[model samples]
Target: MTPHELETILTEIGLSNSALARHVNRSEGNVRQWRKGVSKIPDDVAEWLREYHYFFQKNPPPQRKG
Candidate 1:
C-alpha cells in the first residue's frame, strides 16, 4: 500500500507510529520513513498490518445484550 493508505489505516485503527513500530518490531524512525514516503513499507510489515485489520473486522468483540 502507499504511504497515505498505510497512514490512513493506522489512523483509523487509532495506532500511533510508535505503537506500530513496536508491533512490527521496527524502529520508530522506520515508521516515520514510511509515513513520510522516504521508503516503502516492506511487504511483511504491510501484510502484518493488513492481517490485524482483517482480524479485528472479522471477529469483533461480543456485545452486551441489554
Candidate 2:
C-alpha cells in the first residue's frame, strides 16, 4: 500500500505511528519509515492491517458502561 493509504487506514482506525509500532513489535523508527515511504510496507503486514481494519469497521468495540 502507499504511504498515503497507510495514513488513511491509521486515521480510520485511530492508531498513531507509535501504537502501530507497539502492536507490531517494531521500533517507532520503523513505523515512521513505513509511514514516510522510506521503507516498503510488507505485503503480509498490509493485508493483515486491511483485514483487521475491515473487521474493526464492521464490529466496533462496545461502548464502556461508564
Candidate 3:
C-alpha cells in the first residue's frame, strides 16, 4: 500500500504511529517514516494493515474498562 493509504488505514483504525508500530512489531520512527513518505511501506507491513483493517471491520475490539 502507498503511504497515503497506510495513513488512511491508521486513521480508520484509530491508531497513532506509536500504536501501529507496536502492532506491526516495528519502531515508531519507522512508522513515522512510512507516514511521511521518507521511506516506503514494506510489503509485509501493508499486508498486515490490510488484514488488520479487515479483521477490525468484522470484529471490533472491546473497549477497555477503566
Q: Where does candidate 1 clash, by residue pair? A: none
2 in model 3: Cα distance from truth in Å? Answer: 0.7
In the order shown, what is each candidate's alpha-carbon RMSD? 2.2, 1.8, 2.7
> Candidate 3: global Cα-lDDT?
0.90
Better of 1 and 3 by TM-score: 3
In model 3, where is the ten-residue run with the lowest total lDDT? 1-10
TM-score of each: 0.83, 0.84, 0.83
lDDT of 2 by residue, 1-66 (tens): 999989999999989989988877788898899999999998877887898799999998889896
lDDT (Cα, tens digit) per residue for candidate 1, span 1-66: 789989888976778989999999999999999999999999999998888878877886687998
Instruction: Give the number of the best model, judged by TM-score.
Output: 2
Each model's lDDT comes to 0.89, 0.88, 0.90
Worst 10 residues of 2 by lDDT: 43-52
RMSD of candidate 1 to the truth, in angstroms, is: 2.2
Query: Which candidate model has the greater TM-score, 1 or 2?
Result: 2
lDDT minimum window of 10 residues, candidate 1:
53-62
Give the C-alpha miss distance for residue 18 in model 2, angstroms. 1.2
Error of 2 at 42 (Å): 1.3
Sort the predicted structures by TM-score, highest score first.
Answer: 2, 3, 1
Clash counts for the predictions, in order? 0, 0, 0
Off by more than 4 A, model 2? 63-66
